[model samples]
Target: MIFIRKSNDRGRSQTKWLSSFHTFSFAGYYDPKFIEFGHLRVINEDTVQPGFGFEKHPHSNMEIISYVVEGSLEHRDSIGNGSVIKPGELQIMTAGTGIEHSEFNHSQMDLLHFLQIWIVPEKTNLTPSYQQITINKVLNQFVLIGSQNKQDGTVIIHQDVNLYVAFLTRNISIDYSLKANRKGWLQLVKGKIKLNNQTLLVGDGAAIQNEKINLQCIEDSELLFFDLSSN
Candidate 1:
């Protein structure tokens, strides 16, 4: 089965320096019916002004993943990790017991656009951790950004989930064979595409609980996919 989440139906909030959309229940936008999907908890599309960003905040028992779509994001955490994530970079933070971190735009003239994802960890109180990977080497194929084992340069998380990113030009297509008993979610970060015969535009998403999925690029597109188990 495949369920589509239209881009326009998501919760939206706009501030003078920030614009965001929530795919699941987050912050002040609460919807019981859309609280979560399996272990996938939060999917937030955020754009920050050149000089603005999220202040230092605390998190616990959740795996946070950040994907930069445009511009750059400056990150600093209590774990002694500090870096600037430019376009095509992935950052993952595991707030096992607890952790404090802050994200900033860092750029004086360019706005920062990125996605923040939260997934429920399989076990709590493990340990707080941070890692970032650059994807400049894998621009054409789907690159593993986050996984349980930290393989393929991906940051290790506490759950049995895999996150992948792909940059596809027009007419490019790929088929992903879903593992037995596993589910998938595809989010179109930019441009247009077709997933299992369903057309998806930017900010659109599809939850596929089926056996397989076929993704075809209708235009230049950047996409994110999550393969998760139904725990």
Candidate 2:
């Protein structure tokens, strides 16, 4: 089965400093029908003003990830990790036990655009940790960014999930197969693409179960793919 979540149909939270679109229920934007897909709980496409950002917030038992689409993101956490993440970079924080963090736009003039994702941990109360990596080594192919096993330089997360990223040129095609009893989520970061014959524009997301997927870029595009457990 496949379900397409249109970009325009997502929930929105807008303010003077931040403009965010939520693929699933988030904060004040709750939709009972779109709570989650498998273990993938949240996907927020956010654009922040040059000098404003989210204040310190607390989280627990959730795997948090940040993917910078444009500009730079400055992150500081209670765990003593502080850094500026730019395009083609990904950051993950395991909020086990409990942790507090804040995210801001590092640039004084450029608006920061990024995605923040949250996945429920397999088990609770694990140790908190952080990982970040540059994902520009390969192009037009799925590069593993995070997984349960930490394979191929991917960040280790406390869940049975595999996260892959791809940067494609126009007319390029790619194939992906979902294992038996597993699920998948495809998120379009920018540009246009055709997934399994269905078109997806920027900010669109697709949920798939038990299927072989084929993708062809209609334009230069960037996307993130998640292989998840059925449960």
Best-fitting candidate, scored by lDDT = 2
Error of 2 at 154 (Å): 1.0
Query: Roughly what TM-score does model 2 have, to 2 decimal places?
Result: 0.98
Of candidate 1, the 10-residue stretch with the lowest lDDT total is 134-143
User: Against the hidden true structure, what lDDT does model 2 obtain?
Assistant: 0.93
Model 2 RMSD in Å is 0.9
- In model 1, where do residues sit more than 4 Å from their true spots? 136-140
- Per residue, candidate 2 scores C-alpha lDDT tens digits across 29-102 of 99999999888999999999998999999999999999999999999999999999999788999999999999
Q: Which numbered prediction scores highest in TM-score against the true structure?
A: 2
Error of 2 at 65 (Å): 0.1
Off by over 4 Å in 2: none
**Model 1: colliding residue pairs:** none
